[model samples]
Target chain A: MAFGIGSGIFFAHMPFLKLNGIPGTTYRVMPGLISKRLTNRLGINFQAESFGNNRQKGMDELDRVLDRGFPVGMLTSVYYLPYLPKAFRFHFNAHNLLIYGKQNGEYLVSDPVLDFTTTISPKDLERARFPKGVLAPNGRMYYPVSVPEKVDFNPAIKKAIRWSGFENIMTPPFLPFFGSRAINYMANKVAKYPTAMDERKAILFLGNIVRMQEEIGTGGAGFRFIYAAFLQQAAKRLDNPELSLLSKEMTGIGDQWRDFAFSAGRICKGRQAGNEDFKSIANLLMDIGDKESAFFHKLRKVKM
Target chain B: MKANEVPQDDSGVIGGKFTGLKYATDENGNYVEVQSIGWDAEITVLSQAWDEVNEQAKEALEKVKAGQWSTLAYHSTKCMMNEAMLSEYMDMSKAKVKEHLYNPAAFAALPAATKEKYAEVLNIDLNELLRAE
Candidate 1:
């Protein structure tokens, strides 16, 4: 079974039939394991080194490797990979990909995570973190070999190397933050109108609150509490001829739906459940809210 | 005539361009012209308070961008709703309502009012709660 597994792993790393006639070097290494099989096949002598489980050490190792004119490739856990420099260019969480390559005085990279390949100027690479400077104390660094050009580097390996440049790129602000900003912007807009449109404004505010809760995983509890308060306030300001019992009933139903969703499952778990799951749920909830908000926004436009 | 004394006319005819000259009779019976040039200056400085406010807002927006608000909201809600439910209930003022009503040793202690309200709303008590038992 072990031999079969080894053979399967080996064949998996081999270039497909299309790559057979292609020129260039190819190397593959599984995460957390040394690429002895790939090294033997390439007929290259390479050494493996690990930065003592911290970003600073990793950064230092990165500087040392680049200073010595040797290129480095890293394979690390998903959590650590995103925090590294040039993370967007590489798939730090994946099976196999290179992080750097050189062609015609330009360095090209293919990051599997971002699913994109780009060529960066030599100047940029020189200023790059892993290649030019020390790693953070908590960062991790892995290099396949200490020597340059000993292994026949294939396009796949080149692509993977190029891709690793995107490790630790900053992610954009999340949808929730945008939703909050949108809510605040809309609230300030509503506040400018006079007393005659107070009910309408309150309704719009409630609608936005609902939208925010739904879209950003802001949660039904907070929205429900706020909506209830808004409704009570709107009841005192009921001067509109259009305000009717049916409108209140509909709003009530919406609130009930939100409450049901909020209390539906074990929504409130402790820290032990893992942050990733919570983030996933928050993202999913935000997506749903954003869709709902879009529907309501269209409705509001039609009303206007 | 010497170049310096070529033409001292108030009229702009001596030069191709117009000139700022005023002619007057001198004590020595020679015509003299006075010329003057005008200049203006202005200065402005930005307010430090405005810059500080702008910087603060930018930092707040960045923190929001970094997912700080969402993280805080998630943790706060979890603490308030889940963990707080398992502890002994206390009043809004944090005063103990009853000996059995509030369990200081519970996983998440809460004020009596918040506990009672949550318990009443959630339909669970200390004995029936999973985290408490």
Candidate 2:
């Protein structure tokens, strides 16, 4: 049910970049923004509202919605979600999940990051919804206020493709921390980790990238596979074989991301050395940047 | 992303948190249903992060015991937060929160309304908020 939301289905957010000497450069455009953009473009009627300071009222509204048979999308802190394994939990607060129904005192949850649905107590749900962090959920929730019986697919597909491709490849010159440039910026920062911070800190930093990519549903391969899936759908919808080929290429790029994560993991565990230095890691990232740059560059030129 | 690949072994740590029904391809490349049990490496990383939090909580508890910081500080750390985070959560200015951290007497004397806000934000009871431990 949550998969119908366009954010995770379309472009995967690649928001791991920072300005030099700046702390907390890890930011994404986020699912909320994407949902808004896609829904607006497709003219799919939806409403995403933040409950802000009145969390009790938010809970009431969520109960009302669930009673009305709408599975509501909610922003929450992964760390406070008690159902998640403690080892998989982190401070990230922008995690999205669906609250479909309630029984007894527990809310049925459909977390996109997981492979199966789960349940959470109202108390834990409340805690997860309101967590202290950089990107606190603030009791934010979204739902499809209304959806079209039939979607006009051609324009939607074209627009989504164009928007995603342009956003990732041809980001404005003023925004240095975007698109391929952001990847380059991250590569530079990662290369300096060994010298810029203590050894243990450096490895933790490496581990965080893996955590973001694989553990937190950041899309295994930084969202390349999801984008590929989107392209695959586009290929079928538009009857364009080029898109299918591009999807295969994107999947290969996703493989590269997995490889990077695997290497990073080994280094974090101190199991691999001699060839897994910071420089090599940086180079691997640059290779991804190159492939992504080429892919998006070509994607933007698709005739549709 | 296969049913067989889902690790059922939860020998040493917590398990049984079901995600959702996932789709995987069989040997014939046809879609199949699978239930992901949870990734082991991701759990290990989460455990490591929790250990760090536990260490911080222990330090904060000692400070509370010594009257160097308010019990609120220790509780905040226990909630996986620091002063900056607690300030954000409580919707109080960082400077004010920091002041409260240093002055347990003042914190204890705060209005019930304000105390309630802290307890609610931390997802704890009022008694737990005031407790020294």
lDDT of 2 at A144: 85
Query: Against the true structure, candidate 1 has what lDDT?
Result: 0.30
True lDDT of residue A127, candidate 2: 79
- C-alpha lDDT values of all predictions: 0.30, 0.68
Error of 2 at A51 (Å): 2.6
lDDT of 1 by residue, B1-133 (tens): 1113212323221122222222222454222333311100000001111222344445544543454422222221222222222222222222233222233333134445554454443335633332320
Give the range where candidate 2 chain B is weakest over 10 consecutive residues by summed lDDT: B2-11
Q: Which residue runs of candidate 2 sit more than 4 Å off their true CA positions?
A: A1-28, A67-69, A102-106, A113-124, A271-276, B1-44, B61-67, B102-120, B125-133
Model 1 alpha-carbon drift over 4 Å, by segment:
A1-30, A79-97, A101-109, A113-115, A118-140, A144-304, B1-133
Name the best candidate (by TM-score): 2
What is candidate 1's lDDT per residue for A1-304, written digit by digit as tens?
Answer: 1111111110011112111121111111133333543444445555555544334555455556656666655543222232223211211122233445466766554433333466644443322322211111222334445334554434323222122212111113342122322322323333332232443232232232322233211112223222222322333344322222322432443444344233212222111223343344444444434433443333223210
Model 1 interface RMSD over true interface Cα atoms? 34.3
Q: What is the TM-score of each candidate against the true structure?
A: 0.23, 0.81
